[model samples]
Target: MDDGSGIAPPHIEGYEILEELGQGGMAEVYLAEQKGFGRTVALKVVRLSKYTQVDQKELCLRFEREAKIVGKFHHPNIVTVYDVGTMGNFLYMSMELLKGGELTTKIKSGRVSALEACNIVRSMCEALSAVHAKKLIHRDIKPHNILFRDDATPVLTDFGIARSVMNSGDATGLEDIPDLTEVSMIIGSKRYMSPEQSIAAPLDYRSDIFSLGVVFQEMLTGERPVNFHDPASVSNPSNNTVAWPQEALIFKPLVTKMVEMNKENRYQSIDDVIEAMDTLDNKFVNESAPLRISRIYLFIPLLFLISVAIWILSPFTTNYELTALDPNNRLIDKSSLSIYLVEGLEKIRSFKSLPVGEHKIALKVSGYRTKVIAIDFPLERNTTINLTPVSSPSVEEFYTFQDLLEKGPANSASAKEFTERYGGSVLSDLVDIWSGENAVLLNELSVAAKLNDPSAQLALSELYDRGWYVPKNSDLAQNLSKAAAEQGYAFAQFQYALILMSQMKYTKDEEEFIRLLEQAAEQDFFLAELLLGMIYANREYRSYDPEQAHRYLRRAANKGDRVALYELAQMIEEENPEEAKIYRERAIRLGFKVNQDF
Candidate 1:
């Protein structure tokens, strides 16, 4: 049968080829129908052009070996291998066909949302865990090998490149293959290959984890952490020269650790990485819930006292803070004190109301000078200042978060100059601004926020809430989020309402939670609006008002919320045929399944 590519496709036993899918380095996959069952299946024909008679026999054995390895793993997240056979001179395998495109396509299109990325990563982890349990390592775990089902469920495919941990013989034969027409010595894609795998060293499950980390990074950032060379010359570059990019594209800490170069330093097991991802995900979700800072702040003093006592008893102690400001700053609040000093320099010391302070601060980078100041002061009254290095060495300056907090509506000369140089987009200028001096950026944000700069308020609020450079303070997070929310930042409003909801749940502050959600929904944060709809739709949370829930949910669904579509479809299944038709049609169009039962 002629495939779509107009090539005469190879005929395999028991399967009738209707069309050609595509060809990879060693295999050509075809869209075929199983004769008796009439089920559409993906048939992959593995070419043996480079294999000698002896090598062909060994290749056939290894192909069967891979088929057995993958067939044993039956997971919803993993692609199911149906049968393995040889037709004439070609070795072939058949598997379930996934109608949806690869994960790479979705990532390239920028259609995979953050939440969707998390879900895909989590599912892949589960699949990896299962495969690893059976002692099979999927040496290749790039985006192309990850297939999505019709419902957008990710299924990891192509275990043909998988290595069997139980058998060491497969490794030797693979090494013996001539390089002329063979796959490179590196068994996997260069960009996603682990350090050990790149060098052809003996690999374990950690190798798979490393590849998964690269996939996770690609899913989050829409770019590969390590640039890959062309497939033919992939082995030419020295592995030591390739370093994983340190840019905070994803901003999640756990996934960063998984991609570490040293195998010993990487996640010990797939379970460990999954646990960390889950913890981080839960923390993020919980942070979105409503929260009350007043009661939480009550415990800070007690914790501070205990920390100070421990610090005083420790043998090594070094503490210091910036005590003065240059260029006659008028941004200082009347109640704010500038005389920051370190108490008990010879003993243990702690910074009160600070996020995780360290001792013996030093500036060793080029073009930066280090200055140290010593001071003696009462423990109760002293302000501990942290000096940040400025980009321009000539302009000596000292600014604190408090200065930024109180700065009036007027951009600093430095802020304006930096903004002009780096472009006004907050995300664009973030790196340069952050690298120079975070305190200055914070101060600039304060000025902009006071001046009613919506962008600045949103950026500053996110930095505070996520503890981007500074220590995390939930109180400060809430305050900043509220400030941005007031400026009609949709994301900030959603976050503020979430925090408020969490606080209400913890402290029984129902009134505050309701008020925040109403404000957030009014500003058109569809997620917040969706939550409100759920609250009204469910009898357990609030009164069951279908009309009220439908109004809000339909609005959000119209704006393209997949969850809202599902919920709206559920709500109007039998109640309103006309409205249900609108929602269900929209839901299907938006890539959400109307009935999940299938």
Candidate 2:
């Protein structure tokens, strides 16, 4: 139980408590060491003073509900829950530890740039979109609940008060809790709550949107709009106005719609908000005078010099104009050929203005193998290149799908056609990662996995690991992950290592876990590097090695992981306090958090 001073870290089986991270009214978060895995996790324990039967039952239900809610999310912007269980009066859940701290700090500091605010809102919108897709409402969408990862990615967390919008068969398992409706009503933070939320009215996903809009404004101007605080203010339809700062006016239209007095007047879905925000963000980046001016002076001179040099060299140099013909003797589109100047195979649009000697260039079209052509350039009228197309039609289709996906979100018609054409094939699942439709991806992967595709297996492994739309099955996840790992897929290796680390206790199993992580790290997988760093840095472990820890942690830090930078500082504090302080400060500027004493 938390006293005025602090709460004692609870003794949880299978985890060694390192230190207390923080505490709220209902829970205390502790930094704990997962035994055997040598992994660090933020362990949240339900903290109650003078616990009664009613209070105990309520807290436990809420705690379990949070785990279930967060567990179902397999999104990049949502926190990952590793494990959950009960120990006497304490109900503890282990989750990914985020060192970048809360969005609250940035908002409170009043130093958030307009771009930063936009990024935060965009990321949260995506997260909430995932929430709403599951027929759930976060209820709480304030800055306090939004935490950041080392990469400065905003992560939606703390789902203790989150409730599903649907009344029956909610996936969060809230139906079992008898008083959940009463507990959820009128429960969110007042300063960020919607008028309907404040009045204990039935809430929907729009309530969360209203709260997020308040958060968005706070991030820009360091204060919530007045209309949200008092229910009476928002009750008046005409008073639904926000006084945005001059610099933040670009966002006013979106925010105004988000916090509209009438839910019907607001954006219908998070997807619509995302689409609008994406357009606004792109416009701001492209058209902002200050942003354009920052590079104009340098870019203009560089571009002009290059253009002049090209024009001056045009006459003397031989122009090796090349045309490619497909297997069917049809002229291949120039855009389709990814031309490269040979020797080093450096990418170029065309072999123009080259020396009149033996010249070689490589052509790589989507459905063809990379073909290198040797040309005696001085006297040739025009070079004709013949390209061989791949035998499989699926390979060609896959490339087309890949190209469409790379350009942008594929159109619904194209996506639907691709799925219908290649429904049960490995190629479709391999390319569907960006489809943003989890249900379809799951079904497609389930079929493709049976065909023994490594990529499909890995993808399915992750889906099962998160239990996003299925029952949580660690055994199945481990098996699938292991199969993909054995095929030498780096991401699969990392994931398999994680599953093994969580379950393995034997020395041989620990060695295998480390081996898998090391394999993935060797492939420059930054997640593996981050995990290896943490594992080697754990002082509680017998295998703790500071040198190895620093090496791996530095690798991850170099990859723009702010959490790794913070951890590096913490690891070296005793040996090199001054350098440690520098690393910590660098992490702080990158939006990571350091303890007050540090």
Candidate 3:
């Protein structure tokens, strides 16, 4: 059956292709009827010929592993993967098909109502929470990947680039899946990428949360929260950027925390985000509830009597004023304080008056721990309580250190103070690495590597390979990387593989070199996968195998790699002009310059 794209759908057993639903970088989704089940499903098909091949075995294994990982997810908010199989050079996955349309369509229409946006985000949190529980990082969480059921319940789909977080104890089946890492071959849209994801850094559940925050903001304001011209500014977006309708004001604080550029500052867990959203939902409901005007006369009399009684007892009632103090007993800003009275479950103003009695209340301040204190009115009418600051340094301190560090080693003393304050922390370690002397840094890394720490071994490997703060030593780099690689580090394996190739030992130890590459590729290391494809496709390498070349190239091309696309197109130009034209067009669209009249 022809999918409207003019390409005939691969005939898979037990399913009849109806029409194409959509197509992404690697897969084309079609609406199909499942036999026996007598139900419609989305059949996502990835044609092997579409991407240039690198290694046939590795490509097939990666595809099957991805399917198995996603198929295990069984959440209502997550799209269901029913079955997966290969048919005639095509890998097809049967999944639940939703007709309500993509979240992108809803976002394009205009800003969604506050309630609807909250509900959608709540669903996403639940879905993502489940994925995180399984130790998987979605990597991609944008409106385009979010669909809805007929009832408008948001469902997350597309785990194409999602992978398990490192050091996962429960990520059983996901251990073997290859995750895309190279910046050039990074899959998914860049607009919604988290700050860390943009640089192809290690990711966790918080990465997905940042992307979700971007989508949530877009859904509310009809624009992304990020400043496209200065994406780094997303960490602290000003309230004035988007004119949030008065009704959506409740979402401002929650959304602000979601898109924090520093993952450490973002919501630590999906449950926390969900809880915050629930609070917003309750506040929104209470604020939006219409005032009833019935029984005006009776209500007016009752209100008058209460006002008269309160006025009579004005002298007797003690005015309760709260002052939140910092560690030094200095008063904090009133705007930073959120006071809640335990009695009557009321949220009171910071300086509001209260009745003369012992009252319990909770106080929350930005960058400080929440404190609950009980105070008796009339005895201590005005109270001051010291709020212990959180142990971690605030974002402002980080900025201060960054500015000082930029002044070079001359200002290293000032930067060292900042690092000392957060001693033994990750931030401090990073600062020490950057602000300290290169000789000291190299010595420290060497000591750690000597202790057989894989992380240190990997770091030393890169430093030695590039001659950073040390003389260039390819042999030492290879040995260090191989040490880390032997301990089952995927990135280290990739590095060692490249180092092996650079040493030109592949001519004598071709088997071992290819083994390293496959080991790394099997872990979904993008560069290793790309390298294998390139090596097999080129006659310069003894590993040249046409079938392997095509498989690896196809996988890389499907990942939006322009080089892969251009090369794959050239390889198949004579035999498969039609497919080659499609590949070439894709390359051109990606801004790959080609000579006219090929």
Candidate 4:
């Protein structure tokens, strides 16, 4: 639907439209050049279709109000609002035009790399943080509202739909209406709507987090978590099933929390989400190391004593017992026995009860050379047995694994130094790992995890469940995450719930996921709480009840999750507009921002 002339609505003020950028149900955005500045900008003009003079006046006022709200924000991540005016019957707002396309388009094209996606999200979080700090809630957040420049930096646009904390004088009257003919009962894009928003409840910043979670999922998986043909379908329980495609690369835990149905179970604030991302990054870099040393040191002596006791308890010369030992000449930990068995096997002779007269045992570990030991056991009495592993290579020759352990303090110090020198680069790198190459970065991760690195374990578990770089191994991921969770890693516990939810192949086990999510939420893993909220909000997942979701979401919103604020506002307002108005007021004070189309 284009003409070569590219002229739209004649001429608006002194500016001329060269081409139509796009059109929505309510308005048309144009690619235009300013008359005096010759600078190109996006010109948004209201459609006057089927409107009376009264409606026109109301619409004009709303459009002007949007400009006023957006123009006040001057952050780098926010799109610049240039001018606002009316040309005859057509009212318009002029704003900065980003050359890049919408985030949705980029995701659809499958060109958004994991790192790039994380970077975009980081910028968005920064912007949202700023908006929240200023006490504004973006009522609507969707891919179309985000403009990505050539550098891949995202500029949040469209403040027309933004709910502001600052008083707008009479303009508040227009926003105060219970329902406007132009106001679709559905407030946000169906695929990205928070539970409260889908129900026409009042909303705040938490609503934005819900939408961002959807956006993050789409960026990582190349598809939206929820797909619907119409806005009404968003609230349909039958359409709520979540399935990550086989081809998709997921950080399971992150996706799980992001898509939590409840606002409280999600990240309490953008900062929390950012912190989770940071933890994931550290996990990807080193999986097990210093922790490995600690585990070996703690259990080595115990394992050796147990093996000796088993040997002593044997009754006859017909019995034989075999045990493996590490390079340190200590018995291998029970947890790691499987790996030891797989790696070292010389021969399998007949097995007896125990206390064999004589036996030969061979042992091998990754870094050490093989060693064989000859043992003789007394048939009638307890005897002692000992075997020493040969040191095949010097510490420097085969020390990549050891180097990972050594690199811990170095990397930490380096990161600190880099951060001090280059500001956010070190943190940015960490975010990249958490959000990007988590699965494939296993060796590095194993070193960190073995060292009981909380951050590394969290990232590894997230990658495993999400199938980021490895096969989707929810069981293994859950096990690792459980270990980390037990260690008091909040990020790990939050992600653990996500893995549990995904593996809920049985019906009765749903409560287990809820319990884990609740635990994580208590630790301030806001995303887990938000998921709990969503679960309670929906009748299908509301076995625990909606009140629970509300309670948790309110907690997160209070912590400054913009998306939660919007959701809570919407929920309260549906039943009690006055109460909803108070929540909305709070959302404004908290500073939530979103694209506006009036």
Which candidate should be chosen as best, given lDDT against the real structure?
A: 2
lDDT of each: 0.60, 0.71, 0.70, 0.58
Candidates in order, TM-scores: namely 0.42, 0.54, 0.48, 0.43
Error of 4 at 565 (Å): 54
Number of the predicted model whose TM-score against the real structure is largest: 2
lDDT of 4 by residue, 1-598 (tens): 1221334354687697898888786678899988745668999877554477787877777787677666555455788666888775567788878998888788767746554666577667767876665566676677888887655558888766666433323333335432222223566577677777777665556777778877877776666775534555546636755555432343557766866767788887776776676565434322322333445555567866555445444454233345665435677642222111111221121222222346444333322223334445433333222323221112122122223333553465543443344321212223334334533345445544543345555656766665655678766676677666655555566666676676676666687777777777776666666677767777776365768879987886776555566677777776889877776776556444443110
Residue 292 Cα positional deviation in candidate 1, in Å, after optimal superposition: 19
TM-score of 4: 0.43
If the candidates were sorted by their lDDT against the true structure, best first, what order would they fall in? 2, 3, 1, 4
lDDT of 3 at 46: 77
Model 2, 226-308: lDDT tens per residue? 66555576466556454567667788889878878778998988878887986777556534534544555476677665553
Candidate 2, residue 526: Cα displacement in angstroms equals 33
Q: Residues 1-598, candidate 3, lDDT per residue (tens digit)?
A: 4333436777888899898888876678899988745779999887776555664455566667667777766455788676788776777888888889999998888778887888789878878887888888888899998998775657898886777776566564755556544434455578898878777676778989999999988888887776633745644556337777877888989998998878999999987997788667756654554222233435567766565345334543335467888878898987456565654333443222344457777665644545657776545657788876433233344334445545764677776886778653324544566556456555545644543445467767766665655677876777688776765555567677776666674367666677887886676555556667878988978778988988887876776666678788988999999999999998778656654211
Q: Which tens-of-lDDT digit does each residue in 387-452 have in candidate 1?
A: 222121010011122122234224365444544543434432343344444665565555444333
Q: Candidate 1: misplaced stretches above 4 Å?
A: 1-7, 47-55, 166-185, 226-251, 288-598
